[model samples]
Target: MAWTWTLETAAGDVIRRSEDFESRGDAESWIGEAFGDLVTDGVDQARLFEGENEIYGPMSLHADE
Candidate 1:
């Protein structure tokens, strides 16, 4: 199954979806590295998916205050 992520705001509005990944691990790693940039772009959360099925998230991009 192809793995991907949906970038979104804190209010749950989607900004965009990421490029397709071959595996879940690769998708997760890419997010870990790119989330800094995403946050700067106004993304407050990310949701992981395997095709149309959500695997996890709405994970926060902000550092806990």
Candidate 2:
């Protein structure tokens, strides 16, 4: 199954979605690199999905304050 991320704001509003990934690792790595820019663009968190099933996250893009 393909992996993807649903990017959202703190209020759970969807802002953007990621491209489909070949593996979970690839998805995670892309987020690791992109989340900084995402945060700048108002993405507050992200959820990972494998096909129709959520596999991980609502992971916060912001660091602890």
Candidate 3:
């Protein structure tokens, strides 16, 4: 189970999406923080989606040596 954040422009023409979390709470929190700034300007709305396998983990990790 994971969470996804989606942001659509005011015109609903452009869309931005991000997903890389294991907790829905974390995802929504991030979305709120990010969208809060955009909304102050022109962003119309923001949405959060939660479901199983919405995102995959083991996300590329690299050691800097």
Candidate 4:
């Protein structure tokens, strides 16, 4: 199984995915570094998944700027 990240808008529409990762930690790490830029680019939240199973998130990445 692999993990992935999804970036979504405030309206809950998905914008992108991190493709796949062999480890959840790697997926989380990628998102950690990416969320800031994603927010700036108009993404409002993030979600994590393991295969087809939702693991966590839709957590806010939005920041006042």
Candidate 5:
């Protein structure tokens, strides 16, 4: 199955949505590359929604400024 990444802000705001990939790793790498800066800027909240039932995050990370 393909993996999809959906990123959102702490307040439930959608920031970026990526195309489906063959692997979850690919999807995550895309998320990191696209939003790593925002994440490092102390925007520590995000969610990875995979499907209707498989939302994978609210992960808080320290993103460098």
Candidate 6:
């Protein structure tokens, strides 16, 4: 199964989805590089998935505020 990521707003609305990644590490790295911009764009949460199965998150990108 391919790994992918969903970036979301604080309200739990999906803002963007990543293209399929070759590995979980690659997906995670993409998120790390993109996280700052995502937060600046109002994405307060991020979710990871392996195909249809959610691996984790709605993890916070914003600092506690």
What do the candidate models score in CA lDDT, each in turn? 0.94, 0.92, 0.53, 0.84, 0.63, 0.89
Clashing pairs in 2: none
TM-score of every model versus the real structure: 0.95, 0.94, 0.51, 0.86, 0.57, 0.87
Q: Model 3 off-target regions past 4 Å?
A: 40-42, 52-65
> What is the C-alpha lDDT profile of model 3 across 1-65, one tens digit per residue?
56775555644543565666677778767755665565655455545556634333222111231
Candidate of highest lDDT: 1
List residue ranges in candidate 4 displaced over 4 A: 63-65
Best by TM-score: 1
lDDT of 4 by residue, 39-62 (tens): 788888878999989998878885
Error of 1 at 55 (Å): 0.5
Runs with alpha carbons beyond 4 Å of true place in candidate 6: none
Task: State residue 17's C-alpha deviation in candidate 6, in Å.
Answer: 0.8
Candidate 5 global TM-score:
0.57
Query: TM-score rank, highest first?
Result: 1, 2, 6, 4, 5, 3
Candidate 1 lDDT for residue 44: 96
lDDT of 5: 0.63
Kindly list the per-residue Cα lDDT of model 1 for residues 1-65, writing each as its tens digit: 89999999999999999999999999999998998899889999999999999999889989892
Candidate with the larger TM-score of 1 and 3 = 1
lDDT of 4 at 29: 86
